[model samples]
Target chain A: MNAVSRALTDGWVITKRNLIKIKRVPEVLIFVLISPIMFVLLFAFVFGGAINPGDGVSYKEFLIGGIFAQTVVFGATFTGAGLAEDMQKGIIDRFRSLPMSPAAVLVGRTTSDVVYNVLSLIIMALTGLLVGWRIRDGALDALAGFGLLLLFAYAISWVMAWVGLLVPSVEVINNASFIVIMPLTFVSNAFVPIQSFDGVLRTIVEWNPVSALTQAARDLFGNLPPGETVSDAWSLQHPALYTLLWVVGILLVFVPLSVRQYRLASSK
Target chain B: MAVAGNDGDEGVDELTEMISATGLVKRYKNVEALRGLDLSVPEGKVLALLGPNGAGKTTAVRILATLIKPDEGTAVVAGRDVLNDAEGVRRSIGLSGQYAAVDEHLTGFENLEMVGRLYGLGGVASKARARELLERFDLSDAGDRPSKTYSGGMRRRLDLAGALVAAPPVLILDEPTTGLDPRSRQQMWEVIRELVGAGSTLLLTTQYLEEADKLADDIVVIDHGRQIARGTADELKSQTGGERIEVVLVDDGDRDAAVAVLGQVATGEVQSGDSERALTAAVTGGADSLSQVLAGFAAGGIAVLDIGLRRPTLDDVFLSLTGHATESDTDSDAGSAGGEGA
Candidate 1:
């Protein structure tokens, strides 16, 4: 095999190794799996009737798009945590000593994490369905929604992988990702509509990729979220286009950047 | 001790020089682990880097393997520059670090196979290589087990086997047998010797004098991050001067008097012994000096239980050159009791 295929093969081998860790010590994936499910239950049951906002949709169904967006953006933190821990454990040092391209490491790790995010999405969606979440769109639209979330999460994993590589320790990873993810999630339309907030907060959310993703998913799931504050672009009319834009944009900015960081880090 | 640079030898064996490092220096924060270190390995030869802890042997290996860059210097493995052609260097050299390099999550078979694959072996070739290594390393029985469950020696062997999976001409090992039991250590020594026999040049750092004596065709001794001595085993011993004059005293009472007598006869200071048993020391010349040493002890009325003249050991060479023990017992009660009491 050539360089790229060899790298990808190495990546898959590494990815399988990590997945085995998650399999044996499954507690690693538990937080990622359970938190979203709990949020689905809490928002759909505990506070759904009280908010009683319009659109005649059950709070459970309405919250699906918003929480799916929240779950994946939140999952970015683990990407940093995993890479940092691997480095601290000297596993990354072993990888550095190998002949494989350094970029393969971050790519493999990010791809594996996206697979976990996809699993988390499935668990969250199933839990949402069990509690009466109904999709009003076609199977294709639902599949597209799932694809969008995974792509966004995968892109974010690259950015966080860079953070993990740069950070000195995994302890810093745990602390920094939370500090970064919390504000990014809250300021977006994950918990509330972007229009409900005014002034600069509204401006930030209107342009926020998180909001764009959530609004896009909501439209695809037929949850019927509000629209058109950011631009007159086609994505403003279709959530699919908006989600695609954020996914593509994140890939463009972070993937190469993370790969570059991985290269520099291994050499040092 | 001062060091002189290594001059190129007359005979040329390009395949034997699996690794060559010149003026290699590695810095960690404010500390220099390697200071202008130079090394050469003839094809199908094992070179042992002998030093105590913190002697920069590991740092040298890291630089040669391209796992870490040097502060200033150059290393080449299979003629690939460690700085300019790092990937090429990596492709040709396999490194077994101070720690076990196995992936804990992967089975032994998977770990070896993955490393093999990383070296560009295709599915069938990599798998075949992994299986061959597993059997060669005597790990076939444990190949399916997670490496975490393998014993320390087993893990170390597996790690070394992983390094060889790529069939690299150069192998850099940092303290490969540091923690293994005596039996395992011997086994690893044999494995390394066999590798050299098969045309793989190996540069290994180790604390075990016997390992160096047994395996290394060339020996380089480092202390405080400098190459204090470098030569073949016999050459090093010969450079240390004559054969050792060792005596075992019949009683503890004669120890001091024997020291005084030998102090007069030998060029070096007499090494003292503990209170309980015997006095042993190394000095030059065999039979002629042996009689002189015995006559001196007898004149001093120091009873001699046993006396013998033997060839100088690596330890003798080390002490004759550096005046320090290879395995310094800093934790001996005689040295540390006061501190512990305080």
Candidate 2:
């Protein structure tokens, strides 16, 4: 086989190895499947009454899109943590000594984590619908929304893949991603309408990629209440296209970057 | 020691050079791991890199296996340049590192199969090879269980099996039995012996002198990233002395007299063992020296509990070369040597 095909074949093998880990270790899977359910329930009930999306939009419906955006973004950490753990375990050394492609480890890790994010997304969506979130748009539009979320999650996973290689430990990746992701997810239009914040914060939320993703999901799922319009910013108006741009931008910057790091990351 | 001469005289055939490295200098920040280290192994031969911890054995293996590039110098394995044609070198070598690299969450079967497939074996072939290796390693009963459930020895066997999955012509094992129990270490040695018997050119590193003596056809002794000595085990032993005479006194009070008696017939300084009553001394005339020592001890009324004339161990060879004991025997011989120096 050619180099590209060989790399893909090797990457698929690694991906399968990772997936088998998730299967054998039920504890890891339990946390992955439970976190989204807990998020949906906690935000829909605890913060549901306290927040307003304006114009009679149920907080549950408004929150679902935001939660979807946040969950997938958070899901990217799996890629980083997995890579960090593998680096520490000496498994990367074995892989490096092989005749496989250089980029195969990062590719396999990020791709397998997309499956994780997809599984969590399905769980979160089911929980979202049970708590009074509705899909008023056509099935094709909703599918597009989920597709965008997965694509965005996949891109972010590469960013985390790079972080995982840069950090010394898997625990550090957890804390480091938390410090960055919390502010990015919470400051956006994920939890409340962009109009809730005023001036600088509102502008920041409007331009945030998380905001674009949430806005896009709300638009595609038809979750926007009657007589309510998204923010006037170009990013919010073309939410789907804006989120697509972020996805493309992230992959372009991080794929090669993470692969470079993986090559230099030796077992300590 | 009569370090085996690097005359470049092994028939001058290019095909015999399975592994050749020159001036391999690797530095990690302020510490130099390899300083002008050079090594060569002919085809179908086992060359042991013998040294204590932090001796750059792992660094050399990593360089040869294409896992890392040296800061300076170049190596060729299986006729491919490690620095330039790394992939070609990788295709011809299998490396089992200092630690078992098997996935804890994957079954023994899964880990081997994964390695086989990554080596470009087809799915069916990978599965078949995985089974064959599992059976060979005596891990067939636990092949389906995750490696986390296996014992330390079982995991090591599986890791070695993973390295062999591709059936590469050259294998590098870095401290494969470092942490294993005696039984496990023996089992690992047996497996390695079988590989050598099958005529696979092998390079293995170890801290254990007995391991090198037992397995390697040629041994290179490294210290501080440089080779201090290289030769066949017998040649190395002879370089230090002909044989060792170890005597254990029946009473601790007789130790000093025994030391004096042993010192008289000894060719080199007599060294005390861990126990005050026991001592080992290098002797020149072999069996004649052993009889002389026995007669002296009998006349001295040392009343020895045990005595024997044994061939010199690698430890003695190391002491003769460096004036210090092996790391494992640091407490006793090193202390005696230090005291004598003082």
Candidate 3:
């Protein structure tokens, strides 16, 4: 087989290995499913009453899109943690010594983690519906919104994959990704409106890829309040296009970077 | 004498070297893990790389397995250069590291099957190969169970089975039996022996002299990333002299008398043991030397608390060659320590 086909076949095999871990360790799935549900309810009940997104969109409706974006972005860290754990466990040595394509492990890892993001998205959507959130847009648009969230998160998985290979241990990757991801998700429009922020924080939110991700999801889900105008910032005004650009840009940068790192990542 | 006319047949009868490496040098930032190490394994023969922790055994093995590149060296395994044709080397060799590299969450069968598939075996063939290996390694009953539930020995067997998934021509096992209980170690040795009996060229790294003695056709002793000695197990043992006679006196005051008694039968230098009451001496005659020493002790009026004849261990071999006990060296490079089993 050619290199691309070989990578795909090898990657599919590795992806199967990773997916089996989820089946055997249901606790991981439970935690993955539970966190998004908890985020949905906590924001819908606690902040839902106190905060107004304005222009008559209910707080629950406004919150679900942000929650979906946040949950999937957090899900990307699982890719890093899994890779780090594999490095620590010495299983990567086995993979490295194999005749498979060099890109297979990272490809398989990031691909399998998409399953986590998808499952969490499903749980969050169910919780959103129960909490009085509705997809006001057409079915295809809502699907596109979910697709955008996954694509952006998938790109972020490559970034985390690089971090995972560089870090020495799983704990370090968890702590490192947390330090970076927490602010990336929180300082954006995921949990609050960009209108509430002022000055540099506002500009940061306007340009933050997380903000673009949330704004795109909100627009595609039709959760944006009727008659509410998006910010004039090019990123927010064309959030879908902006998020797509970040997705492509991140993949372009991190794919080669991560593959290089994987080649250099010795278990020792 | 009668075979003098058959000289030409001897050339054809010689085994091909399946694995050969020359002047392998690997350097970590501050520590040099391998310093001009050389290794060779003839077809269907086992060559054990023997050393203590941090002796660069793992580094040499890693280089041969194509898991890491040597700073300077030329290595060919199963007819493929490690640097220029790493994929070919990888394809021809199976590597089982010190740590059992099986995925803990995967079933024993799944782990082997996954490896087989990665080896380019199709789905049906991979499944069949996994089942066959599971039976061969005595893991059939546990085939469906997650490998995490396996004992240390079982996990090692599964890892070995994973290595054999492709039936590669050459196998590199680093510390295959380290950390295993004696029974498990013996079981692994038996499994390895079975593989060797089937005529697979094997290069294994180990710290246990007894293990090398039991399994390897030739043994290479290394220390601090350099080759210290290379010979068969018996040749290495003979280099340190013969059987050792260790005697512990009942009274510390008998130490002088004990030394004198031991020295009479000693072929080499008589050495004092850790305690003042004990002494050790290397001797030529295995049983006769013990009887002669007993007679000497009796005549000299030396009372012994404990006495025994023992074979020289890896420690003896290391001490004889390096002028230091194997474990006494504390300057293990970080690279080796990470790769060496505890």
Candidate 4:
């Protein structure tokens, strides 16, 4: 009836439809399970020892924060791919003719991916715990850490979905999302400390949302603190707060912008 | 009396137009698709948009369905401004497309139910709607089967059923029966006729002149995103000026001599078919011209296999209007073949 209710109903229907698709295909859940889980295991074995603790916590625990940021951002790149596929398949055009709010389709799709990424994070986090990583903070703090990661995932995914809407073809999706996502992930302190870099790289990492999220999660993990980390925005002064600020800030800006683009393009 | 194709001017009365668009322009990249197109559809009737490839018939339908917006036009569906009231426009219309829009992963039943749910029907009400559409479309038995396995006609039927799930008052079809077999196309025609009989307004775009002749209450012919002519089927055919005299030649070479001889009396347009073996000319004065036409050919020693007087078809109207055929409106072999995997 109204915008909000219509958007909610449309989003729910799309989410349900996607779920039906997943039920029929079944390969998609693997990304929300095995794919991210495998990446976590890779980081745990390959880069765990390199993540030295600045405040005397174990490197594996320190890696958790970086892993959290890495997993969600990696998960986000698929949003664009899914969108590109839907566009190529003409689903977007079909949606344009529907009576519901056009914006709701994008919101529902991005939210659905956020749900998958959150599930993946849980699996990855549990895998981390099984291998001797522990969060010194209480369960509430761990949840807050996850909440920040999910929010960050949603904001980034929204941008990528817009990219999906703008890209010319589905063939370009993987390369495009990866090209956009990888540099942002690597530039952040996903695998190492920004302090370890002395110049331009350090400056880039410091302002990076990926770095902000990792720093926020590390603070929430009570794992370790970099001398430069703050605890204000997400967990205060830590990049998590900055990341949270950026997450909400990005969602606020990009979600509406993405909806506008999707609606305009889809209208054709 | 249906006057279904009104082409904007809303104060003109709702009963005058089932669908209307003015200055409907859609541009993709540097190319303009529907450039300054104006169209209309009156209530409880059918109007067909006829155009060759890239002429913007599909674009107009897309705009009218509210699936896309015109860059510089205003469209109102079922009496609501398309740009300012898109949702209301969407609520008042149904759309069936050239390609079946049903989800492949879902059963026929599920596709209709999903559309119902998206339209805000509760579960029970939605399922009830789905059942009704499925049965009405003669898809009840296989409604529970996945759509991917359905035949082309079956999938298309499912798609049309899904569009009607909400029972929208206005229906827009974009070359919906393009590749359907005769039976399937006829079935679709019956369904469309039934919709009009029930007082639903309809607008359709088609490459098939015969389909338009058989179905449309009125016809609108467009060329290069502009209206060339609009009239009833018989009205258009009658106004085509001269009766067409077609001569099927024994060889393509005879075409030149045939043209040369018939050139004397061909006071109207002359077009050679693609094979160059069949030469057709519109000659005036009916019986007099027909006689002269035969004498000229006989004197030229051209063997005339067959001769007949025939009313101008929509083909003649299109050829006269656009100087080409409408069936080439899209890329060749695009959704055009297959015995229809039924």
Candidate 5:
């Protein structure tokens, strides 16, 4: 087989290996699905009374887009932690010795994680619907919104893949991604309006790619309250374009970076 | 010791070297794992890398398997250069690491099937090969269960089966039986012997001298990242002066007298055991040396608690060459107990 076909076939094999883990360890899938449901409930009810999205849109509708954005981003952590755990195990040594494509392992890893993000997205959307969140836009726009979230999540998987290869242990990868991701997701409009932040924090929030992603999802889903004043920031005004740019940019940079890291990575 | 010729200038041989490495040097951040080590294993032969922990055996194996590159060396396995054509080298060899590398979440059959697929076997063929290997390794009963439920020995057998999925021409096993129980170790040895008998070139590393003697056609004794001795097991044993006479004294004060009597029959220096009440020496006459030592002790009126004639073990070989026993000597309680029983 040619190089591209070889990588795809080998990667598909590895992808199958990873997906089998989900079947064998249902607890992991339960935890992955449960956390998003909990987040949807927590933010929808606990903060729903106190916080107003400041428009005709109910907090639930505005919140679903943010929840989708945040959940998928957090879902990227699975890639990092999985790769770290694999690195600590002897399985990686077996993979390295194989005549399969070098990029296959990373390709397989990042791809299977997309399945995880998809499952969590479905669960969260169902919980969101129960809590009165709806896709106000037509079906085509809603599909695009979900697609964008998955695309952005796929890019982040590569970033986490690089982090996974860099960290020494699974625990370190979890802690490290948590440190970076918590701030990135929180400072964005995922939970609260970016306008609420003051001074320097506002600038960081406005420019954050995660905020752009949340804005893009809201736009595509038509979840924004009618006549709600959108952020004047160029990124939020063209949120879809901005989010697409970040997706392309992240994949371009991190894909090669992660594949290189995989090449250099050695298990302890 | 006669070094294996690095250049193919030695008289023409009917056998080809399936694995050949010269001047292998690998330096980790703090330790030089391999320093100018050389090795050669002819096709269909078993060459054992006999060494203690951190003796660079794994480093050498990793280099030959194309899992890692050596900083200063050239290696060719099955007619492929390891550095320049790593994929070719990988295609030609099967490697089983010190640890069982099977996926715990996958069934024994699935793990082997995945390996076969990675080796580029078609889906149907991979499944068939997996079943074949599972049956051969006696894992057919557990083929459908996740390998996390497997015993240590079963997991190792599954891991070994994975390596053989492609039936690569050369097999590199790094400390394959290092942590196995005696029974499991015997089973693994038998499996390895079967593979070699079927004409696979085998290079295995182990700390057990008996393991090497039992299975290896030639033994390469390495220490601190360098080859100290390379020869057949018998030649290596003779280098340590053949059989050993171990004596336990009834009185601690008789230690000096015991050494003096043993020194007459010993071809090498007499070594005192950890306790003052025991002494051991390497001798040439085997049982005759034991008889001579008994006569001398009787003539000197020295009391003897126990005495026995035993073959030189890997520990004896290490002590004779490196001035230290194998690193596993103190902590390997089971291994030492088995040695005493032998």
Candidate 6:
């Protein structure tokens, strides 16, 4: 095969290797699957009675989109952590020493991590349904919303992939991703409505990509209450388009950056 | 030592020099892992890089393996420039690093198959190659088990097998038997010997003097990121000098008399091992020195528990050159920084 074709083919092999880790190490999958369920239960029940999205909307319905946003965003950490852990192992040196494409490792890692998001999405959706979350929008639109979430998560995975290579340790990647993600998810419309925030925080939330993703999910799922309009900011006005821009922007910036970093990354 | 031909003979067509590097310098922060080191390995010959902890053996291997680039200088492996044609170099070399680089989660077969695939062997061929290697490494039964479950030696064999997946012309092994048991180490040596016997050029790094003595056609002694000496094993031994007469006394009291007698035949400094109740001195004139030492001891009435004339080992060579024993510091000074992390 040609170089590019070989890279993709090699990437597929690595992706399969990663997926096998998920299978062999079921605890990883269990923990990943449980967090989304726990998020659905915790936010829908613990914070459900206290937080209000608006009139005509149960907190459960409002929380589903936010939960999906948060879960998928959290899922991106797997990519970074996986890369960092692989970095710590001798396996990476083996990979580097091989004649395979350098980009294949990162491409495979980010690709396989999409499975984590998909699995958690399935579990979260089931849990969301049990908790009385409903999708009023048509099935195709809802499918589109899920697709956007996966796409957004995949892009975010590249960002984490870059961080994974930049950092020194796998444990550090976890804490590092937490530092960046915790604020991005919580400060947006993930667990609370944008209206709940005040002044600068509200403006920040209105433009936050997490908020755009959550807002788009809510719009597609028809979870937004009638008459309760989103923020007037252009980002919130076209949440899907804004979210897509962030996805594209993140991929464009991180893909090559991480690949370059991968080339430089040696097994310590 | 077979130094690189300095004639700049571009058309020499010497396939013998499968790997060569000049003035390789790698710095990790303030530590210079490799400083102006040069190396070359003839085709189908084994070159052992012998050194202690922080001696830059691994650093040199990493550069040649194309796992990391040096800060200054250049390397070519299998006729490909390490910097400009790293992929080409990689395609021609099989590298087994200090730690076994096999995946723990994957079965032995799976790990080798993955390596084969990455080396660009197609799916079916990768599997066949993996099975073939499994059989060759004596791991056919354990091939289905995850590498994490294998014994350390088994894991190491699996790792070496992974490196051989593509049967690259050049092979680099960095301390391949560092943690192995004696039997396993011997087994690994046998495997390595077979590879060399098959006419694959090999460059291996090791702290064990015996390992280098047994496996290497030529030895490079590196310390503190620099090449101190390079030669064949016999050449290195002879360069260190002639055999030494070691006299051990039954009691510590006789040590003084034994030391005095040994001094007569001693050609170099008469060194005493205080706790071992022994005095050793480098002696020239071989058998003549031995007879003189024995006759002198008899005249002095020094009780001799043991006495022998021993040839210089690589250990002696290491000590004579580095002013230290040939033992693993368990860490190399230059090993701490600058290599890329995966």
Worst 10 residues of 3 chain A by lDDT: A168-177
In CAPRI terms, model 4 is classed as: acceptable
Number of the top candidate by DockQ? Answer: 3
Quick one: best TM-score, which candidate? 3
Query: Model 6 compared with the native: what TM-score?
Result: 0.90
| Candidate 3 whole-model C-alpha lDDT, 0 to 1 | 0.89
Give residue A54's lDDT in candidate 1 (0 to 100).
42
Higher-DockQ candidate of 4 and 6? 6
TM-score, chain B, predicted structure 1: 0.75
DockQ score for model 3: 0.69
As for DockQ, the candidate ahead, 4 or 5, is 5
lDDT for A198 (candidate 3): 92
In candidate 4, stretches whose alpha carbon ends up further than 4 angstroms from where it belongs are A49-51, A54-56, A225-236, B1-15, B23-30, B239-315, B324-342
lDDT of 4: 0.75
Which is superior by lDDT, 3 or 6? 3
lDDT of 4 by residue, A88-168 (tens): 665676677878778777877887887788778879888888877888889899889888888888888888888888883
The CAPRI class of candidate 6 is medium
Report, for all candidates in order, the number of backbone clashes. 3, 0, 0, 24, 0, 10
Candidate achieving higher lDDT, 3 or 5 = 3
Error of 3 at A96 (Å): 0.5
True lDDT of residue B237, candidate 3: 91
Local accuracy of candidate 6 as per-residue lDDT tens digits, B213-295: 89999999988789999988878876787588877787788777777777877877889765568778988777888998889
Estimate the TM-score of every prediction: 0.83, 0.89, 0.92, 0.81, 0.89, 0.90
For the candidates in turn, chain A alone yields TM-scores of 0.90, 0.97, 0.98, 0.90, 0.97, 0.97
- TM-score for chain A, prediction 3: 0.98
Query: CA lDDT of each candidate?
Result: 0.76, 0.87, 0.89, 0.75, 0.87, 0.87
Better of 1 and 6 by DockQ: 6
| Predicted structure 2: clash tally | 0
Q: Write the per-residue lDDT of candidate 2 for residues B45-67, one digit (tens) a residue.
A: 99999877666788888889877
